[model samples]
Target: MPGVAERLTIDHVGQRGDGVSLTNGASLFVPYTLAHEIVETERDDEHPERRRLLQIDTASPERIDPFCTYFTRCGGCAIQHWQPDPYQAWKRQIVIDTLAQAKITCPVDPIVDAHGAGRRRVTLHARRGSDGGLRVGFAASASHAIIAIDACPILDPALDGALDAARALAEVLKPVSKPLDIQVTAASNGLDIDVRGTGPLPTAIITALSRIAEAHKLARLTRHGELVLMRVPPVVTMGSAQVTLPPGSFLQATAAGEETLAALVLQLCKGAKNIADLFCGIGPFALRLATKSKVTALDSDGGAITSLQQAIKDTKGLKPIKAEMRDLFRRPLVPQELRDFDAVVFDPPRQGAQAQVERLAASKIPVVVAVSCNVQTFARDAKILIDGGYKLESVTPVDQFRHTPHIELVARFKR
Candidate 1:
C-alpha cells in the first residue's frame, strides 16, 4: 500500500481526542496528531483501518510525555499523552458539548480532583499464556488480545501486587483447568480475590494459590474482611455497625472515593428533613445521611437492600430509613412515589438515569443530585432535569479513573 505523501493538517480532536479528518470521503482517525498539526499518513485498505500517522511534520502545544512506559501498548488509558490542564479542559468541554447538543443551559462548574483518587474497586479480564509464562493485563484497545503489564500506576498500591501474583499462579495451574476470570479488590485490612469458573478448583491449584498468597504476604481474609471469596456473604463494618455483603454484591472500590461521594451527598441534602436515595448500594450515602434526617433507600439489587437493612438495624441514633428492592429501570419511582421526600439523590450506572431522571423531573423534586461516570450521559440527564424546571447549581468532576477518559461527575440542581 502506498503511503500518502502530502502533509495532512489535523482539523480537530474527536470524542476520544484522536485527530479526525476526511480523505476521499472516508473518515481517517490518526492518534497523537493534535489539532493544527501536520502529518504523513499510511492507509490500510484491507482492514478498513483509518489512516495512521507515520511522521509528524508539526506538533501541537497540548502534547506531553506519557508517564507510563506502556502508554501506547496498554489500552487502559487514551489521553495520558496530553498535558494535564488541557486534558481536563477537554473533558469539561465534552460535558458542555453534550449539554449544548441537547439544547440545555446550565453552569458547568470547574472539575474537582479527589485526594488519593484513581482507586478502582473491581477489574475484570481473561488470563493469557506467553512463552515465558502466564501473563495478565488489560485487553488491547478495540481488540481482544491481552497486553501484558508489569504494573498499573493508576490503581492503589496495595492492589498492584494482586495482578502480579494472579499471573504467577496461572502458570502453575493446568492449561485447561484453571478459571479464566479473576477479580481482585482492596479492603481495609488487605487484598481479596475471587476466581470464577465452571466448577471447583482442583486441590493442587488451590494449594498453589495458597502458597503464592503466603509468599506475597497477601492478606489472609476472614469472612468479615473477604466478601468475594466465600460461599456465604462477607461481613463489612461501617462505624459501629456490621453488614454482610453477598458474593457478587456491589461495594465502593476505595474508602476515599466512598467518603468523598458520601460527603457530597450530604452537602447536596443541605438539611432537608427527608431525602430519597435511588440505587443506594449498601447504603454508603443513605446510611451516612440517616444521621441528619429521614432517608428512603431504594435499589434493584436485593443483596444490597438486605445489607442496608442490616446496617440500619446495627447502628443506633440513625433516623428512620427504609430499604427496598425496586428495579428502577423497569419500574422507576413515579412522581407520586417521590411526593413525600424533599430531596433526591441518584448514583446510576454508566448508561445514566434516563428513566429515573424523567420520573424524578416530573415529580418536581426541590433538589436533585445526579452522580455519573459517563459525562455524555450525565449531560443528557442534566438536560432532562433542567427541562423539568430545575436549574443546574453546580457540577463537580471527580477524577476517579486517572490516566483515562473516564470521569465521575456530581451535578446539583434546585427547583
Candidate 2:
C-alpha cells in the first residue's frame, strides 16, 4: 500500500507543467492541480516516482472541465484542464525556455493558431486487450499502455470515422492469429486506409471491408478521389509535376499546414539563389522553393528521394532542385557541401536537430530557417547556432497541433 503524505499546498506547476508542491520538503508533482491549490497526496514508497494527488482540497478558478470524455485515460493530449488562453501561453513559454537553454535570445512573435486544425493524416498502433482488438490510438503518457479510442476530437472528421470503421472491423475479425496495425490519411480523393499485418489481408476480409466502405460512403485506399489499390501510390502532380509519396512516407499531415510552411520557406529564401533543405521529406519545402532558386534537398529516406526526383521531372516551371539520400546522423552536411547555398532550411523530427547543429554552425549559411516540433530541442539547437555566431532573427510559433502541448515553430537565423 502507498504511504499517505500530509496535505500539501500547491505552489505552481513544474517543467512538466503539472502543478507542483512539497510534502515534508520533498517535491511532489500533481496533475490537474493548479497554482494556489491545496491537495492531499498519496506518496509511492516503492519507486522514485513523484507523489500523486489523491484529492484537491482547494482548486484554482482557472481549472475547467475537460471537453473530452477520455481526458483522464486517453493519452492523446495533455493540459486539457487548462483554459484555452492559458494553455496557449504555457506553450509559448515552453518555446522560450527551449530557446533559453540553447543560449539564444530572440523575440518570439505571436503564435499563429491553426484553423480547422484537427486534420491528422496518419495514426499507427498495435492491437490491445484480451480479445486482441486493434488499439489504434496514442500511447499513454510516459507509458506503453494503449488508449483505445473510438473518436479523436483532434483528428479530421473523415479520419475519425475511418478509425471507427477500423474498430468495428476489429470486433468481427478472428481473435489473434496475427497482429494488426493501421494507417489512415486524408488524400485528395477522400480517405485512405492502410491495414498492415504479418501477412496479406485475407481476400474475404478485404472484400467485406470494401463493401462496408462503399455502403457507408467512407473513403478507402484512394487519393484525391482516385481509387488506388496499393497503400502507396505513384507520383501525382505538384504544380504539373509528377510527385510520388510512398506508403509509411512522412508528409505534412494537413494540406493547409503544408501550404503555410511552403509560403514561409519561400519568403525566408528571398534574395537567395541557392538553398539547402535538410531532412527534406518529400520536398515539401524543396519542391516549392524550386520556383525561386536552385535547392538541394537531403533526407535519409530513399523512397522519398525517388518521389522527389519524380516531382522535379514532372514540374515544368520548377527551378533546379536535386534530392539525395543521406543519413544525417552518420554524415551531416559539411561546410564544403553548404558553401554554395546562400540559405538553409531544416525540418527535423521531434528529437530536434542537435546532431547536425555543429555542421550547421560550420557552414555559416547567411540565412537559416530552423523548423521544429519539440520546443526543448529547438532551444538546444538554437543555442548551438548562437554560439556559432548566428544572430537570432525571429521565432514564430505555429499551432500545428491545437489543444495539445505539441507546437511547431520556425526560427530564422542570420549570420
Candidate 3:
C-alpha cells in the first residue's frame, strides 16, 4: 500500500521539466504537475529528492486534455498540457536561462516550431508478458513497466499502426521470450526497422522474417547491425539529394525539423565560399550548402561519410563537396586545418563538442554556426567561442521535439 503524504503547492517548473515545491525548506521534484498547481505528493520510493504525484487538487489554467491517450503513462512527452504559445515561450526562456548561466547573452530569435506531420522515427520496447504473449510499446515514466499503446497521435500517420507491426515481428522473432527493442523509421519507400536485444537468428527465423518483410512490404529489416533483408532501399531526401540511409542512421525526427535547421544554418553562413561541416551526418547541411559553396563534410561514422559521398555523386547540380571520416571529439581539425575554411558548421551530439570548439576558438574562421540539442553543453561551448573574441550574433531555438523538454538551437558566432 502507498503511504499518505502532505499536500504541496507547485511553485514552478524545474530545469528538468519537473514541478518543484518546498517542504520545510527542502525541495521536492514532482513529475506530471505544473507551476501554481496544488497536488498531493509522497516521497518517491526510488529517489530521495523526488516526490510522486498522487492527486491534483488544483490544476493550472494551461492544463488541457493531452492529445494522446497515453500522455503521462508514456515517458515520451513532458509538458503536453501547455498551450502552444506558452509552450514556445517557455522553450525560448529555457534557452535564455541556460545561456545566461554561462554569461553569454545575445538576441534569441523566435522559436521555429516544426512538430510536423509527426515523428518519423520511434523506438518501442517489446517483452514477453506473464501470459507468454508479447507486450509492445513505450515504457512508463521512470519505470521499466511497458505501457502498451494502441495508437500514438504524435507519430506520423504512416507509423500509426507501428505497435501492431512490432507485435507481429515480436511474435515471429520471440525465439526465447526475451525483451526486444524495436526501432522503426519511416522512409521514402516504407518502414525501416531494426530489432535489438535478440541473439543470432537461425535459418528458420530468417526465413520467417523474410516472409514478414514480404507481407508488410518493409523497406528494410536489420537485426542488431546485421541485415536481414531489403525489399526496397530506405531513402531520405535532404534538399535535392536522396540519401540511402545506412541501418541505424541518425535522422531528424521530422522532415520539417530538418528543413528548419538547414534553413537557419544556411541563413547564418551566407556568403561563405568555403565551409567545413564537422560531424555532418549524411550531409543534412553540407549537401544543401554545396548548392552555393565548396563544402567539406567530416564525421566519425564511416557509414555516414560514405552515404554523403554517394549522395554528392548522385546529385548533378550541387557544388563540389568533399566528404571524409574524422572524429571531431578525438582528432578535431586543428587551427591550421580550420584556417582554410571561411566558415564552419558543426552539429554535434547532445554531449556537445568541447574539443572541437576549443580548436575553433584558436582559429581565425570569420563565421561559425553551432547546432546543438542540449543547452547546458551548448552554453559551455558558446563561452569558449566568446572568450576567443567571437561575437554572439543570434540564438535561434528550434522546437524539434514538440511537447518534450528537449530543445534544439542554432547559435551564430562571428569574429
Instruction: Say which candidate scores most in lDDT.
Output: 3
Winner on TM-score between 1 and 2 is 1
Q: Please, what are the lDDT tens digits per residue for candidate 1 over residues 304-373?
A: 8988898898789898998999899999999999999999999988898899999988996898988787
Candidate 2: residue 331 Cα off by (Å): 2.5
The reply for model 2, stretches above 4 Å from the true place, is 1-6, 40-48, 51-55, 124-126, 131-143, 168-179, 196-228, 231-243
| Colliding pairs, model 2 | 98-379, 102-383, 188-224, 189-223, 189-224, 189-225, 241-314, 241-315
How much is 46 displaced in model 1, in angstroms? Answer: 7.4
How does each model score on TM-score? 0.85, 0.84, 0.97
Q: List the candidates ranked by lDDT, beginning with the highest.
A: 3, 1, 2
* lDDT of each candidate versus the true structure: 0.72, 0.72, 0.89
After aligning candidate 2 to the native by TM-score, how far in Å is the CA of 377 from where it should be? 2.7
Q: Which structure is stronger by lDDT: 2 or 3?
A: 3
Shift in Å, residue 34, candidate 2? 2.5
- Stronger candidate by TM-score (2 vs 3): 3
lDDT tens digits, residue span 1-415, model 2:
4775657788876656667776567767776677788888776564455666678778888889888887767666666777777777877887787767666678998777763556657665556657654576767755667787766776766464667656654543444355556667765545556566535446666566566566544445432223435433533334445566565566675666676667777887799999999999888888778888898999999878888887787678888888999988778888888888899999999887777888888875899998887788888888888889898898888776765667788878999
| Candidate 1 vs 3: which has more TM-score | 3
TM-score result, candidate 1: 0.85
